[model samples]
Target: MHQYQFSLVFFTVLTQWALGSILMISLYRAATGGQELNNSKLTAIALWLICGFGSLCSLAHLGNPLQGYYALRGLGSSWMSREVIVFGGINGLTTLWLLTHLVKGKENLQQTLGLITGVCGLAAITMTGQIYYAVEHQPSWHTPLTHIGFVSTALLLGLATLALVLRQSSKEMPAGFRALLTASVVMVFAVTWQLAQITGLELNGVLVWYRVFASLMVGCGLLVMAKSLNLHSTAMVGLAVLLMVSGEIAGRMGFYGSVLGKMPW
Candidate 1:
């Protein structure tokens, strides 16, 4: 991948990771009825930092970072523009929600903001997928599988990340965390299978299998170990995250590779 595509890999993966983590955090809270966990402040700060970095990666992908603001001009029509706008909103809302957490007795406001941000984050991820799905001539990217793959990747990465965060407080697993982890793994497997079926002549066979092995097989294996061993340390979960992230990056490369050589311009 070239410089811009490299930027996109981090842009999509990291942003989605941040979005997914916060969403799960909120869900976990709701499921457990406002159970407090250690390192909550640190998690918020880390997510904010990730969002900031992801935004910068997006700007770099524009080729002229200084002129990236012009991308907003197309909000009336372009999915790219809409993505930028929605992400901006997500960032702002996330900041406010983080601020709420800094204060005491704001549980109600914090939960509300978190839920809203989570919903908006979903829309932003959708827009990111739509940017590729809108290419009418690119059969590989035009499929609905593109959208499914993006969302599933986000959830998988998010769930893995949340597990790491929660592990910081207690090695003991949370009630819903295991269920979400299982669901995320299933979603990723489903997306990979569908992508394999739909992606013909667009991606290399070897690369596709590499992604399946690295992301689906190895990553899932690590997750299984973490769950089965009931390991409290971040070691197993951390490795799982690394493999899963790498897989998502490879998948994105294939997603772009399908259309890169065929650009009309």
Candidate 2:
């Protein structure tokens, strides 16, 4: 894998995680009747920091960071350009929402802004997935599965991160929330396995190690989450997040490694 690939993997995964966090946090607020404004503010700050770091990783992928503005010029035809635009929109909207929350302290307007930010974040995730799905030369990447995998990664990482952050804020987990999260993880893994079968790619390669490690880590994380719920241990939630994030990083590495572009030979 090239250095650019690594940078891209981090950029996409981190940004998606940020996006997912925002969306999940919004849902959490709504589900809990919007009582925890202070906790929500902290969560927004953490997500913004994640987005900032992801943006920096994207810059690392560039040959000349100063010319990065040129990427926005191709928005008429390039998915990459659209991805940048969408991400910018997501960041901008989120910032505006954060400011509104801080200055105005109006829950109604803040909730509205949160909804819009979540929509933009979801669009950013779609555009990120489309960047790879539009690659005609890479058969391994040009598929619906790529989009599904991207969304799944976002949800998995987003929920795990949210769980940890909320726990830190001393927020109680809503009833059935843990069960819902676990089911989502299981469903995503099942779909990913099915997609692998559909692609019919050989499972015997260096990439297989990444896949196996990711699976084991994610599985362990889910088990840990379940145990945490049973024992009511907030610390275990943090551990679960760590495991899930590491697993996702490994899975994304495999995702990049699986690319098999058309050969001139």
Candidate 3:
């Protein structure tokens, strides 16, 4: 577990969550006929800030932050290089879209920029997954399941966080949507757990406990979110987000804990 990089855990989860939020927010807007939600602009800004912080965390993972530019040199053959490039694009485009929305107030151009930002976000997240999937020696991470898990993490946290933001802002979401979103979170976790089991990766001691606790926390959070939806309790929604975020962080730690480099026989 000593080799597990906490910076990377934060970087991957935070950036993916930010990217996922953009896509989900776009879908939500389309579904609601572009109805503007209260504080939606604030939400977008907060997400971009999160992505920026995550990008910094990624730099912290490097031995020399100044030398980080060299990572782009391997774009032709390195998943890491591609991931970095895509991440930069996502950050730049999203920031530009945010600025246009705040300053120019051009609805049509904002929509165009949003669409482009969302596409780049999706590409960035996929490339993030590929960074691990390309590790041929690490069989545990070489499966398509790695990509699935990354995307799932994005959606699960993205939707939950988005719901929290909307509810807190006193914005109205479509009826029963929160419950549906929470259910999807549960479903994603179940699928991820099943896939991990199928992989038969060994987990001992604290690692096993981490997995169990993370699952429990996430389950509890989803249940709370579902109940809060029915009760229209904003406080409960906030609590659920807290729980889910904590659980996700723990789950990511467990994921890093499970990494098994090629065993030298």
Residues 215-265, model 3: lDDT tens digits: 345444553446555755666765665665556666666566557322342
Q: Report the number of the highest-TM-score candidate.
A: 1
Ranking the candidates on lDDT from highest down gives: 1, 3, 2
Off by over 4 Å in 1: 1-4, 104-108, 171-177, 227-232, 261-265
Task: Kindly list the per-residue Cα lDDT of model 2 for residues 33-135, writing each as its tens digit.
Answer: 8756445666677778888788789889899999999998997899999888777777788787777666765657666677677767776777777888888
True-vs-predicted CA distance for residue 142, candidate 2, Å: 0.9
TM for every model, in the order presented, reads 0.88, 0.82, 0.84
Per-residue lDDT over 99-186 for candidate 1, one digit per residue giving the tens place of the 0 to 100 score? 8778787757876787788778877898899998888876767887778777887788887777776767664547567777788778
Q: Which of the two candidates, 2 or 3, achieves a greater TM-score against the reference?
A: 3
Indicate the worst ten consecutive residues by lDDT in candidate 1.
198-207
Model 1 has an lDDT value of 0.77
TM-score, candidate 3, is 0.84
lDDT value, residue 149 of candidate 1: 77
